[model samples]
Each structure stands twice: as structure tokens, then as C-alpha cells.
Target: MRYGSVCSGIEAASKAWEPIGWKPAWFSEIEPFPSAVLAQHWPEVSNLGDMTKIADAVRAGDVEAPDVLVGGTPCQAFSIAGLREGLSDDRGQLTLSYVELANAIDAKRRERGETEAIIVWENVPGVLSSKDNAFGCFLAGLAGESSELQPAGGKWTHAGCVSGPERVIAWRVLDAQFFGVAQQRRRVFVVASARKGFDPAEILFEQDVGSGSTEANNVGVERRSSTVDNCTLYRFRRTDSYIDDGVSSTLSARDYKDRRELVVMADNRVRTLTPLEYERLQGFPDGHTLIQYGEKLADDAPRYKAIGNSMAVPVMRWIGERIAAALPAEKLSGDYGGSKTPPDQRDLWRTPPALFASLNDEFCFQLDAAAAPHNALCRKFITADQNTLETLWADYLNVPGYVWLNPPYSDITPFVKKASAESRNQIGTVMLVPADTSVGWFREAIETASEVRFITAGRLAFINPVTGKPVSGNNKGSMLIIWHPYPRTHCHFATVERDELMTFGAKLLARREAA
Candidate 1:
């Protein structure tokens, strides 16, 4: 298989897929250091220079159509570390360029009567929150839907088709640690196949991929960051200030200097990760970036930047393998089936079991029932479809029962609004939601909720009601928003340590059984 990469930082994709019978066609990188690294390592392959010109090049026949196209586009514009400008930012615009290039590549191949190239993309999860629904626009573009980032520019469609969903696309937030990488890096990977009806989720969403409780592959005794600060750095945003688990927090290019999310090691004496260690964390060889690329780039900062910006090698390798396994074939438009899994094959996708229970108490009313209504812990339960907001104001207001909500993540505004209202009106409530303090609902919760308990366990593997299995992972951190009844608010807003919720679930289960 032949592949080309865009925004190719140190060519992690090449390193990953080359070992598994994949050859490099070209690399599109603008940064001098990374471009040099690519030129040095893979001298035989061409450097496509800027991504903006890739489509034009392909159309001009200057570049051959690759079998696969992979890239991790610039993420800062959408990252929390930045202003979150998203697609509006210059860097974020490159994401669209990626899509355009893929469309052009696929079209070029089709003209030659060859198989269309598969497209793989990676980005920070923050892209999901791009301004003016940019994420939705990008998805619509990938799925062969006629859409544009701006409505004023008329309809946008992928090349070569009048467009009736000609491509199959799927996306999921995947953690690198799950794919055998030690670093706890969570990224959103989107895969698109030119072969209509091919589901990318089938290749990307396998369960039980994480190394549960396993220590990261220790490179050597010298695997530590370069930061010399004596102050202990903690995970300041959601959880405590120190790393409890061996998994390193998401490795950013400026993590050593920014010190915003990460801190010095938990121990006062432990140092920051070395440049080589950063490479190791991303599943690259020890000296992958340390090599002589052109003028011998020896600076550790450049190495760190390149490594942090690249896709995790192991994660990409797994994706490549899956793609390879399903290759040498394509079905006609109507011949391909839907993306849903068959009942017989459901076991392959079921998440592993974890500790969780529905608690029944005088103060508890499970609003969103994972199971049947009556099966919930409370005397009253609300099904997912039920509008708990209107009900809370009409019937449940002034009722003393504590509200337990595990609402759907798509839109948590209504749920948060209702929960906050109930809590203000003497009804206690607790919500289990992602630990995203940047959202509007979170701010609303802070105004009313007594505590925003960042779950120390990180992502909670909520059990799937149908199969009685735990979800693979939420792909992000979770938190509990506890709001006590008014006139009893001494500690209005506080952080609950990780251990507080460890036995909390068990005790609630026992209480329900006794009641």
C-alpha cells in the first residue's frame, strides 16, 4: 500500500505503517525542522510542500494518487490550550485543506479506474466544539453531504460526484494508552473510505484495547522531563496537582513550559520527561527525531514539538492493519450494507464490565433511567425520552428527593437548566457529565451546584444497559455536579477528591437493596 501524509510532523505515519508493508508516496509539511526530518529519513519520497497546494498538484499530475492519505492537522486553533478559534483561525483552515486534498486524490484515482484512496484524520477533541458548527460542516463534507463552512459560499461537495453520500465516514475519540502507547493522550480520529458503505467505526472502535493498570513501557532510568523547577506540578484544571496514575497526561508541545495543565512530577525530586522519552510515549523509536535531518537539528524543543504534534504511531498502526485486512475489495453502491453491527457479532463490540450500580434512597430520583423506569432506585423514574425539565418545574419542585441525572451528552443544556432550578428550589441534585469546565452548562452548574466533583478515576465506564457491559471509555474525564437544597449550602462549591466516589457507588447500591 502507498500512503501520503499532510502536516507530516516527523512523519509518524510513515514510521508506523512502513513496517507493515506500507510505502510512503509523499509528505506535506511546511515547518523547516519537520520537513528536514522527513527529507532525511525518507529521501526517496517526495515532499509535497504546503497542504493548500496538494489538490492543485494532484490535478496537475505532479503527484501520484496514494492508496491512503493520513494526517493530524494543526490542532491549536481548536485546542483548549489556545483561544479555541477553531475553523476561523488560519491553522484550523488547514483541516479543510485536508478534506479538499482527499477529495481530489479520490477523484484522480477514479479517473484512472483505480481504487479511491482512504482518508485518515486525527485532531484534538476540541474540534467537536468548533465555532458555528464547523465540526458538523467538516463531517458533512466527509460523508459526501453538500455542505460548507459558511452558508454564503453556496453548497460544497466532495469532488467527482453529484453527491448522494458517495463516501462512508466514521469518527471516535480514541485514547493512545488504549492502543499500547503509555501516554494518556486522547484524540479524535476520523476515517473516510471512498468505497461507499464502508464503516470506519468497524476498524477504529474495538473494545478492550486499553492496558488496564499496566505500567507504561519504561524506556530506561532516565525517562523524565527536562523541566528543572522544584515546585510539584499538578493537573490543575480538573483533578489534583499531581499525577496519581503512571499514564502521563496528554503530551503537548509546550507542556514543559506552559505548566498550565501539568506540573512537575508528584515527587518533589522527579524531573520532566526527556525529549527521547516524549518520542517513546508516542510509540516511536528512542532516536526517531534525534537523528540527523539535513543540517542536524539537535535542539530538544524542536524534537518535543514534532513528537507532541504527531499522531501516536501504535494507534495509526492498528488503523492501518484494519484497513489492510479489509482491502483488495470494493462493493457496488447498493451492495454494501449499513454500519450497525449484527446481533450475532455484538459481543465483539460490547465494552468490558465495570463497577456501577443504581442507588435507591429517600433523597434519590434517577431521572434518566438506563434501564426500565420501575427498575430505577427511586420511587419515581424518568425515561430518557421524557422531558425531565418540564416535569421538575410542574410536579417535582419542592419535593425533597435528590435528582440523579446521567443525561445524554449531545445536549446537556436542558438537563443542567432543570437540575439547577430544582436545586435552587430546595431539591437536591447530582449530575454525571464530562469534565469540561469550558462549556456554558458547566458555568451554569457552578452557579447553582454545591460541588463540581472531578472524578479521580478519570473516565467512568458506565455499564451498557442492554448487554450488561461497561462502555469502553467515555474518551474523556468525567465529573459529578452536586447541588444541595437551598438554606443548607455551607460548602457551595468544592472539589471532591477521587477516593470519595470510589465506595460511593457501592454504598448507594447497598442502600437501595436495604430500602
Candidate 2:
């Protein structure tokens, strides 16, 4: 099959389809850096300068119109790094041009005997994420011309504008890591076809996000997901998995900086992969072509830009091949699996440290006595499930012993109520929680615990499931609140700097009440 590629990133489309005997008649890349890599590697291909110029030029070419047009446009303007100007913004508008060009191609194909042609495109995941449907609006604009966008009457926007489906865009957000990319890189796909009813939905899949996929349950908590079947390929292999169950590993940004914070296959001890490895992990073939150009770039530049900018070739090809199969072998047009585009893959939660603890005066009785010798501390070693949080409840307070508590954030209201009820009892409990002081739970924990020891620090120490070692410098800090043995309802107030809080949670645990 012959196709045309524009705004291609590192030629992922070329590599993905080349093995299938797919050939590219022409291609374009405006960026000199990636263009350099493409030229160095695939030197025989012809180049088109810009999408706007090439869109019409290709349409009018003496050669036949491409059955498939593939592009993964640059998305920095809408990325986190910049003000999310979207397609309306100048730099980001290139995406709109792609849609227009594809529409033009579809129209030209329609003028001829051709009834079907497919246009497959990719972009950052942020496109589909917005509640405003900003990206959707762009796709609607692409389906027709400026006329349909601004309908005259109440019909289809513009009364006299170009109407009907000139081109169809069916898209979904996907993570490269899910397709076997080592790092959690997300990209949105916009699959536009001149044919009606073409669907991109069949290729969409899901996998667990975040750390801890080997423990058989939630991270530092009980199992939340249902029975995990091992057969499902989340991304590709060794990709997305839950913290406590599946054998797959989490791909964190820390892998870029910390060598120890990586997943090593026990069989080979492949010390995790370099950023280059991360690229390969994501299905980019020999992106090492860009590596030689690194010396000209800054130290943090190569992997930083390459990984962020790359598309998982396997996932892309999977989507592309699906589109290709849906269409007639020589033509591009099919009904899309009805759906929307996808969003980016940036990490949502940066884990914070455990700060305040709640306890049942009975369960914590031993702990209180340990702080004051009034309660028995020696016999309080209670068996607790590592999956379920260990907590001090009301019944434990009645027992004449010290209480040990490690509670989950869930149902904190009951724990606070139990601790508050023991204002006069000789029991105290400490718990871990986020540092948000304004929350009612913190207020309750502070109001009831006889004495509060607010451990301040920056990053907290965590076990990187990827590395199984202390996520040392990677911690943002956490808290360990130790309530005094005495029974008095008192709440102390203080503030913690991020760095100090990080250190205090991971390295130092001073009583904030001290000074």
C-alpha cells in the first residue's frame, strides 16, 4: 500500500508500516532536529515543507492521491509547557491545517470515481481531555469547511456552508506505556477518513496507572480492583499494572534521573534502560538516530525531547493497520467505531507523606503507656494485614494495653470520632494522612489526641516498586503525628515548608509542638 505522511514524528509511521510492504510516496517534517534524524536514517524519501503548502500541492499532484495520509503533528502549544492556546493559537493551528488538507483530499477523491480514503493523525492526549471539547470542535471544523462551522439558521450551523461529512475523525486517547513503552507517555489519535462509519474504537484498550502492580492489591492498602487476569496485555509487556498485583511495572519519570529507581528484569539485571531504553520500551525502533545529535544539544535535552515527542510505533501501527484493514485494500474509507479523542499521560498524583494518625483510645492504650509507662507496651504487637491498614478502634481502647495504629485514609470520620470520645482516657494514637490542615479530619485528629507531634519534612521516603528500594531523593516528604500519652483534647497549629516537610517526613520527625 502506498500513502503520504505529513508532520511525521521521527517517521514512526514509516517504520511501523515498512515491514508490511507499505510504501510512502512523500513525507514532510518542519523541525530540523527530528528532520535531521529522519534524513540521516531514511535518506531516499522526498520532503514537503509545510502542511498548508503540501496539503493542496499533494491534492493537485500528477501522481495519484494517497489512500492513507498519516501525521503526528507537534503539540507543544497545547502541551503543559505552554499556554494551552489550542488550535486557535498560531503554532497549534497546524493541527487544523492538517484537517483542512485532509478534507481537501477527501473532496478531490470524491470528485473522481474514488468513494473512500483514510486520513490517520496523532496528537498529544490533552486534545480530548478538556471538558470544553475544544479538540472536538476542531474535528467538526475539519469534517467540512468554514461555512458549516457557522451555520446560518438553526439547521447545521451555517445554512449555505459546505455540509455533509467530507471527512470523518474518530479518535481516542492512549498511553504508549500501555502499548509497552517503558515510560508513561500519552498521545491522542485523530483518525479521519473520507468514508462514512469508519471506527477507531476497536483498538482502544485499558491498563492500571501509577505505581505498585505486583502486590496483589492496592498500594499500601487493601485490594480495590477485581481479580487481575495475567493474560491481558495492558500496553505491550512489562507495562501498566496495579501497585499490588500484576507482574508488569510502572514507568515513572524518575527513571530519567535516578538509575536505582528503575525496574530490572531479574533474569538479566538490565539496570533499567537509559532514556534511549525508554524510547525502545515505547516501541520506537533505533531512535538512537537522534542520539548522535545529543552533543549538539544540552545534557537533559535528548531523552527529554525525544521521549516526550515520540509516538509508540506499535500502538500507532495497531491503530493504523486497523484503519487500513477497515478500508478497501486500495482505497481509504470506512465507518469508524463511534467515539472521541484521547488525553495526555502526565502523572496525576505525586505521592505525599503520611502526617496525622487517628486511633481508638483502647487500641492505643499501650502506646500511651509506652510514652508514659502507665499502659503496657510490651504486649501490644497486634497482627495486621499488610494489605489492610492496621488501626486502633474503640474496642481496643477498653483493653488495658498500648495501641498500635496504621490506618487508611478511608472512613477517617469514624477513627476521628473514636479518638475524640477518648478525651479523658489514658490512650493516644498516631496516624498518617495528607498535610492538608484545613480538612475536617485533621481538625478532629488534632482536637482529640492529647498531644500532637507533627513531623515536618519535604519529600517522603517510599519503596519504588520499580526498584524495590527506598525512593530516596524522589520523596516529596510526609508526616508522622505522634499523640502524647496524656488524655487532653488539644490542637496545635503550625506551618511546614516543602523542603523541611520533605526532610521531616523522610529523615527528621521533630514534634512541631516543641517550637
Candidate 3:
């Protein structure tokens, strides 16, 4: 299949694409660091220097038109990495380069007798909003002033030469971690193609789904830093999940040399990811990032810059898979062009399975029963993608036999002390807290836990499910604690020592679980 790439990096994608039997017809990239990485990795292809030079290529026709083009455009203008002035911002305007190339490619492809080619566009979720546009008028001329495509699916396609994807563009949000990547990354992708004979419904459904699309509706098409989906995701801020040891992490600027964020649980132990761990989080093949690449940059710069600019490969791979499923076989010719997967007989919009909600309700009901007395319960049944500490807290509380409280190691001393004291001031409870022996919270928990163990290291890790072993060594932060008071003779019924309970200074929140 004909394919082209722009805003290319070290070409981690080359691996994923090569397996699909797709060969790159063009490669475009910029910057010294990434170019070196790309050159070191993909030395064979025609490495076009810059995407901004695309308009010139179309004018000159040096860049041959292709049937399929894929790119994650330079998104600094739309990234949290910089001031997010969407289109108006110079960097955000880079997206227009992709759009310009799309238009140019299509026009030229028609000239070359190619009927329809695929256009895969990926970018930061923020670009979907107009409020972030910066360069304004300059962008008007970039992609021919076409409006942003609707972010729904199953609403556009062809019905046998009946004005197919013709001009209809479709888009959706997707994530990498769920496709088995170690990190949590979300992206938005848009697809546009000439209408020939396809179903708009299937096209819309594809864009509306295929991984990580459950979240678009949660947001109100507004723009205030397209960060997390909503405030429901802010529970990490109010608690200790941020420096989680096993779960891979976000690449923050400060954490470039090393994950500046360390997981410090209740025992004073600390854990954070190494650059190697960061590589795994981004879905690279094991040891894919050369040691020199990671080692050459002092500290975590290699890891930070490499992953920060990279797209969640799994998400894009999923897009490729969806595209593969929707498109006629690459060799489709003669008859299939006018063929139709008609309106009545289609599998694209199958009704969602009833089992997930049915089974999850049972899990929630059982979990809720167990965590009943302890006011900490999770709110609802969230999917695999549902890890917001707030939602988890609300939902966890609903489960039976558990009071899952993971408070931020630094800001949780007072809260932990309260949850601790409220356990009948002596009844047992389990808390997955930071092991920061130095932090007042850990000290408080340590001073009290009838049993405390070094479960694992966090702050950064690959994360083992049963034993909680981190992929990286245990040089970071955090440990788990299980506090159950020993049955001592009646000195004080459910005796809770004031020194141990000393961190308890705030009002305790005693609310019933949400039924």
C-alpha cells in the first residue's frame, strides 16, 4: 500500500508498520536530536527534512502523491508542553501543514489516476478546540478553510459510487495503555478521504470507536487545557496515586532526567522509574531504545524528550487496525469500488454487549457490601480505562471486604490519621499508602500499623499484578501497609494511641456508600 510519513521521529513506528506489509514512500522529520535517532534507525528511506516544506513540494511535485499518509504533526501549539494557543499559535499552526499536505496529496493523486487514498491524522486532543487557535488568519489559507470534522462515527461512508467518504471527515479519541502499552496516553485522530462508494455510518462508527472512544461524551466540547477528561479525574491530585510504583507514568518536564515524581508509601521506602522503564511505558519493544540513546542524554532527558514527543503507538496501531477493517482490501479494484456494505445488513453498529454492565454491577454490589462500614467506596463501574482515584475511591468503597484508601503520601497525613482513628479507633483497616518514612503520614502510619511490609517500589515501575514487583529495581519510593490492632487486654477498648493517632487533627468525613 502507498504510505507516507511526516513529523516522523526515531521511527519506532517503522516496526509497527513494517509488520502490516505497508512500506513508507516518504519520511519527514526535523530537529537535531530526533533526526539523529531517525537516521540511526531508518537509514534507507527518503528523509524529507521538514513538514513545513510540504507546500513547496506540492508546488514543485517532488513529493509524489500517495494513497495513504500518516502523521502525528508537531503539536507544541496544542500540547501542554507549551502555551496551547491552538491554531493562532505558530506551533499549533503546524497542524495546517498536515492539512495542506492532505489537500495537496489528494489533488495530485487524482492527477496521477489514483481514485481514493487514506489520510490518517493524529494530534493532541487540544487542537480540536478553536479557543486555542493562535495564528488565526494564517491557518485560513493552510487547509483550504475546511471546518473541523465532526468527532462522531458510523455517519459517513460510501454506498457504491454514491458520494462515498467524498468529503466527509471523521474523528475520535483513543488511548495507548489499553492496547497493552504500559503508559497512559490519550490522543485524537481524524481521517478524511474522497467519497466514492462507502457507508458514512461505518466510517462514523469506526471513528467513534475502536479503542479509547468511550470518553468523548464525558467532555463538553469546551477548551480549558484539554488535559484529563474531567474533574472526576482529579482524584489523583487529592490522593497518592500520582507516584504509583507499578503503573507506568506520564512524562513530565521535571521528570526528564529521571521521574522527578517518586512513590513514597507508608514505610519510608522510595521508588521511581528509570529511563528504561519510561521506554516500556511508551510501548516500545523491549530494549528498543538504544542504551546510548538513553545514556547519551544526561539524567532522564533521553527518556523525556523521546517519549514526550511520541504518539501512543498502541493507539495509532489500533487506528491502523480499524482502518484495515473498514477499508476494502488494499488490492480492491474493478468491482468493489462501487460495492456497498448496505444500511440494513451491517456489523459496524452492533449493539453493545450487555454482559459488561451486568457483571460489573454484581462486582460493585459485592465490593460495596464489604467496604460498607468504612465510608470509603467507589462511585460507579468504570471500564479498564477508569482509573481516576476519585472514581476508584467511590467504586472501591462499594466492593465487599475492602476499604481502599490511597491518599497522597505528602498531603494525606491528616486524612490517613482520621481513617485510622475511625476504624473503631481500633478496628482493622487496609490502606495502600506511601512508604515515605520521612513524611509525616508514613511516620504516622508506621507508628501505628500492627503489620507493615515492603510490598514493592513505585514512583516508577512496570508493575507486577500479584506480587507487585517493579520492572525497575527497588531504588525508588513507597511500600504497602496493613494495620490491624492486636487483641490486647482491656487497657482501652480498641486502643488507639494518641502518639500514633497524633496526625488526626482534621474533621473525619463519615458518609454512607453510594447505593
Candidate 4:
């Protein structure tokens, strides 16, 4: 298969896929050092300077539309170490340009009576929770949705799949250490295909259910140490440094000077890793970046930056092998059935009546802070048209009572912030959300909440808006976060069973109705 690559730093994809008989049609890179590296390695392929113009060129019949398109756009805007400005930053805007290029390639290929181009995109995990919802915008563009696609829960899980009218897209977070690399680099990879009966999930997710092993492969290398007077002193460093247990921390472009990991040898001497070592960590050949420029050999500064900004070779090779195997196969059966609701409305599934009845009895909720007329659990509630984020909770509740919120899962940052502010207004607030403790918004909720209760028995079966029946196969666990006006020394933690809650709630409702 021939492929076009954008933001191609040193052409890691080509290096990885070459053994699988995949060729590079062209490369899009503007950086002088990396451009030189690409030219040195693959002199026959052209290097398109800017990515913003590639889409137009393909549409105008100036460039060849390959079978696949791969890129890892600038990720600083969404990186945790950076400012986190998201799509507002000029670099972050390249992500949308990538979508445009993909569309153009697919359109051109269809004109030539060829299958649509497969797309592979890579980025830091921070893009999943960008304040501007950058990931939603990217996914919508690829899937041909009119609006941004919201995640099922308030936050995106480590992996998921979405099938739209145009394509089937799947994403997963993969760590480099698990892919034969000695560095702990976690990246998000998205694979999409417009081919009939082709499921991207089959490429990204393993179908083997019986192999439950989670241990890393043993390299069979002994630890570096020195023996003095029959006493061995193993080499080690402090946790502040990135080196620990023979694994290196993530390599970043800024590691040339700052954030570099240091190693303390058995002799008690300290030193930093060299540029050649950086290449080895990323699975690159030795001196891959050592090229002859205008006058002489390139220096170490640019080599360090180029190697640090590259994709791990071993990880890319695995993905290429999977794609190669599925490229020529017959149409597969059991394709993902499209969602029942539009991408924007999929999060509107209502809370189960029994679960709400059980919680309302204990909290005495008077206002449903986030709900529509049909799904509201309380008599007094606010609807989406009323702008719950801007509406005051006290206005909905005349007396002292709790407010219940099961907010939209697409962008929960605003809802979380609003909920925290409401808790400070002498109003009790109880929020039901996915039990995702790793996100930043969850941390904010925990800091302000008076209590947290995790549902332990099983996942909750939410009520389907269309069927009016419980929806099974819920993937994530649920939790209730409470912020009450009453003073407490510390936040209380507890667990409850779903079966018990539903059973008790049904009996209580029946007795009250008989009275």
C-alpha cells in the first residue's frame, strides 16, 4: 500500500512500514532538520512543505491520492506541560486541516474508481479532555457528522468506537513501554475507514478474550551494578528524575535542556542520556538523524529535538501489520450498527426511575438541575432550553433541598464548574456521573464534595429514551457526588448495590401509593 504522511517528523511511519511492503507516496513537513532527514532517507519521494495546501492540491489533481493517510499533528496546545489553549492555538488548528486532507484524499480516490483512503491519526491523551472540545470537533469532521460528537460519559474513556454515515472510527490509548520500547510514552491512536464492512475496531482492539496476562515481557538483561569488597551497589536514581526500574520517562522536544532524565551510576557519577540513546528509546536506527546538511554533519541539538518529536517505530510497525492483513480481505460480517440517535442526542438517555426514586428518598431532592420535561426526576426542574449552566439553583428551589444533576456527557467541564459554584450557595447538590477519577474535572468535584458513593454491585441500566426500557450492556461504573450545606469534618465514602437500591425503592413506592 502507498500512503501520504503529514507532520512527518523523520518519517517514522515509512521506517516502520517499509518491511511490510508499504511505500511512501509523499511527505508533508516544513521543519528544515526533519525535512533534510526525510530527503536523505527517501530521496525519490517529494516533501510537501505545508499541510494546509495539500487538500487543495489533491482536489486540483496536482498530487496523488494514496491508499492511506497518516499524521501526528502538533500536540503542544493540548499537552499537559504546555498552556492547554487547545484549538485556539495556531499549532492546534493543524488537527482540523488534517481532517480536510483526509476528505480530499477520499474524494479524489472515489473519482478514480478506487476505495477510500484509510486514515490514521496520533496525538497526546490530553486532547481527549481539552477545554475547547478539540477531539469532538476532529471526530465529527472525520465521521461526517454535522455537529461535534460527545462521549457517552462526561469524559472520554481510554478507548471507544463511533460509526457515522461516512465512516467507522475507533480510538485507543497505547503505551510505548508495552510495545517493545523502554520508555513510558502513552499516546492516543485513531483509525478510520470508509470501506464497506471494514471495522476499525478490529485493527485497534484485540479480540482475544482468554489471554488475560498483563505483565510486560522480560528482556532477560541483568541490572547494572558494581561489587565493592563483596558488597553490590545497584545503580539507581531518585523519583524526581524520569529513570526508574530500567524504564525511561516520556521523551519530549523540550528534553534537550529541560525535563531530561539523569542516571546515577554504581560509581555515584551522574550523567544525562545522549542523542543516540534517545533514538534507541524510540526504536530508531543509530544516527538516524545524523545527516549531512549544507556544509557539514548536523549538530546534536537538532537531532535531539527531531528524535524526541517522533513516533515509536515498533508501535507503528504493529499497526501497519494489522492494516496490511485486513486490506485485501473479503467484506467482514457484523459491522457496527449505527447509533439510534444523532451524535449530539446520544447522551440524553434518562436515569432509571427506580434508581432515582431510591436516591430521592434519602436526599429529598427538590430540583433537577440538568434534565428535560420528559426525563426530569423532580417536579421542579430546569431544561436544556433554560440554560442550566447560567440559571440559578436557588431560583428553582424556594426551600432548602438538594439539586440532582446528570449533566450532558459531551463537555462536563462547564457543568462541573457550575455544580461546584452552586454548592457554595448554601444549596445541597447531588450529581450522578461516570466514575472516572483520572480526569481533572473529577478532581475538582472530589475537592468540593462532602461525600462520594460508588455503586458496587453492577453497572446501572439506564432508561432508553426511545424504547422506554432499561438499556443493558452499560460499560462504565457510576457514582454519586454529594455537596451538602451541613458541616462535616471530612468527606464520607461508601458503596451501594444496584439490585438492593431498586428492590427497596419499588417496595417503598408501593407502600406510599397504598396509603
* Candidate lDDT (C-alpha), each: 0.64, 0.48, 0.47, 0.78
Candidate topping TM-score = 4
Model 1's number of clashes is 9
Q: Mind sharing the TM-score for model 1?
A: 0.54
Residue 486: error of model 3 in Å?
98
Specify the poorest-scoring 10-residue window by lDDT in model 3.
Answer: 346-355
Give Cα distance to truth, residue 377, candidate 2, Å: 99
- Lowest lDDT sum, 10 consecutive residues, model 4, at 332-341
**Candidate 3 at residue 415, lDDT?**
47
lDDT of 3: 0.47
lDDT tens per residue, model 1, 49-123: 888998987765556567789998888888877688888889878878888888888776655444577888888
Q: By TM-score, how accurate is candidate 4?
A: 0.59
Q: Per-residue lDDT for 405-453 in model 3, tens only?
A: 4432224555456445534333344544434454455556655565554
- Backbone clashes, each candidate: 9, 66, 76, 0
lDDT of 4: 0.78
Per-candidate TM-scores read 0.54, 0.47, 0.51, 0.59
